[model samples]
Target: MNNLNKELHLTNRPVDMPTLEDFRIVEKSISELKENEVLVKTLYLSVDPYMRGRMSDAKSYIEPFQLNEKISGGAVGEVIESNSDNFKQGDIVAGMLGWSEYNVVNGHALNKINPELAPVTTSLGILGMPGLTAYFGLLDIGQPKEGETVVISGAAGAVGSIVGQIAKIKGAYVVGIAGSDDKTDYLMNELNFDKAINYKTTPNMKEALQEACPNGVDVYFENVGGEISDAVFTMLNKFARICVCGAISTYNLPSNEDIGPRIQRTLIKSSVLMKGFVVNDYAERWSEGIKQIAQWLNEGKLTYEETITEGFENIPDAFLGLFKGSNLGKQLVKIAEPTYAKL
Candidate 1:
């Protein structure tokens, strides 16, 4: 922030995989914090698939990242300086910090975190946006019923993985579809999913879904919306609820005119209630989900996994990995660590 340190700042728009050249080092004088503001030293950064949508210059649930601007998302950092009565110099908080060494945050924009239960890093993973997406999206949209059959695509991802676990805990039979065997193993073994199917290896998805959910899908957690979801659509039971959380499979495609899944006819016959949601739609209830997730983590009812990249230089790598299904869990970046480290 001063002559002794510099920040890695984004300088260009990246098509897919961004390189160091896409960013530049910027130097600036450290300024004193204003009233109700806190200076935070960045510790962890979140790299998610949704950020990809944000990078593109398109109108959606949120605004796109401007070219040559320092991009920001969810980040965990320590309060190095504070002017607010509510926070102190050593408190840790999570909020929208940009891709840099430090950021000034209004006290209202930051949420203080407890470091003991699962590690402060988990605040960027299981206790972060991905976790809330899974919690509210499934409960509020999917409305999964006990003994009902629930199917989730992108089963190994941050949101999808937790969706399966919550469904199982609600007394529903959960089945997950992923891209690799190791992910399938994680879903079946570690997460305790009732069954896990490898979509890359399976030749017929319709048959796989039918075999996995002999009773038919009662709640569809739509994580990937390509041929996999098309097949699952045909297997939905009457009055099924579909939570359209994401469409990673269709994201690369230009638009719905080219890549959206086709199957509205099945929806009419099954009387399915399919709803698309952005997690922020329930922003008023964000804390409720976080509190519940924290309770679940404390109770050992939920386990979280993360694929963390160690530096800001690798932010792009961490991001692009989501599309290739290379990450087994939540993907994040550790931008800096002048002090914090795993014990």
Candidate 2:
């Protein structure tokens, strides 16, 4: 066991796109565990689109990351030392931990992972925030029904992929819009999406969407805003429900320059319903979402993919990759190997 811990800190904020120089990796000595705290060795760290919003000073659903501070997000770790009765050494847990090799966190802040049920890494992806985000945003807000046409932007992404699959399970004809032809093929061939559009290659997204969704879009799972969303808005049927989960296309742009087509007229004319949400809004129902998603996974109704990057030193690169469309699914950095396996 090592006595030092390495952490990645945000040194500078980017004006346009994030670069590797914006983050600095530093080494520190691990401290002794407190009475109610446990010492955790990080295994997997999740890099998500929402974290990009936190990199800036702009006010939003969450607080911005402070300069020269340890960056934190979803992480799955193993408890190496415990001072709390709720947790024991060798217990696998997941929580909002730092971009570090080890973290000393309060036991209450971490949830123990049942390795017998699923791989511990999943606690950072499908069985965690991403899964919950898809569940509430799609089922609660979009509300796709039988024979409805569902459209998902950023459909190759973590949350969007799950949203499309859930829409299919509800008997909807799912249409996915992705950045690459390979992603579109994966959506149709692997995920069983009814149709898919490669936004980058399609000259006229509106016309392509019109041809694919003959009946118009009943539910729109908005992940990437801007032109893709503008095209989707034009094809919305009466009483269409739009779940505004994310707008990744504009996350890196300066706030003043982050503009897109206004949908007010479209909403009014079609009587469409649009609502933006964060996963924390459904915090109380997290277990419910987990149970359902887990059941689906066990029954082979749900499938997920992860793009794993090895080593903690590459955390910044993994995060920056999110905007470049470098990953096909959930992007994660593997920090360390699990010391104990309960399963």
Candidate 3:
């Protein structure tokens, strides 16, 4: 194999919405693998809403991407060269690797993937961080009960979609809020959600939400913020629980001006519990969540959808699709097909 590697680097930060010009792809030569290091050939790369925060030089839970350096995120790849005892060539693995065709990483940083368990691409979607985010956020923070009404914002997204399904598994009536009628249909018909609301078309979100959640919202999995969340807040029942996850609705806004309607009074009046969390906060119990989700997946109790964009050059386009609501479920960029042979 040639020693050339292609990678995408953050060139500039956008004041509003991100544009393709903010990133530049460059080619470099791959280096020799050292002890405890493996050379990875990326197969599937993730383009998530969270990555948008890292694009700017802002104070955040994770460090911002350095200008002119390779941007890194979740990726599933095959080992092309290994100098580590723990991994051998051709082992499929998942880790935080650079947005590149090839990456040289420490073997300890990667989790070995069993191709037979599920599709390797799932390591970047339902069976990966997004799935775990839904599990812990809903079960731990939302704490839904049987016969309760659980409302999920950004319901057609990767995380919200799973949250609604898991709520159903727990015997709660699930209501999903998506951006389009097609996405709403997917939620109601395909995922078996109790109801689905197209926020884009609905003239009165509060009235629609009130109609859908006749029992009042007992658990709200908040993935999109702004006007959608304000409406959900108005529908909260006593002792309601809210899990504040990614706020894709406000990610593109200028940091200083990113504000919304006050909800402190709503929380105080209803005795609602609202908590925000990053998925890494549950790192210690990740395996447990993965085990349960995988079981549900195998038994057909859980299912997922993927909006995969082909070719490495379309990575930025796929990522931008997240903001425009161009994807139905999990949005992924298929860079290359996996080679299932050990060297």
lDDT of 3 at 340: 58
Off by over 4 Å in 3: 340-343
Q: Count clashes in each candidate, considering only residues at least 3 apart in sequence or on different chains.
A: 0, 0, 0
TM-score of each: 0.92, 0.98, 0.98
The TM-score obtained by model 1 is: 0.92
lDDT, model 3: 0.92
Which has the higher lDDT value, candidate number 1 or candidate number 2?
2
**Cα lDDT of model 1 by residue, 23-128, tens digit:** 6666665567789999888888887777767767878989988776677889999888889898887788889887777887789999888776668877777787
Clashing pairs in 3: none
How high is the CA lDDT of each candidate model? 0.83, 0.91, 0.92
Model 3, span 251-338: residue lDDT tens: 9998777677788999999999999999999999999999999999999999999999998889999999899999988998989876
- Predictions: Cα RMSD each: 2.4, 1.1, 1.4
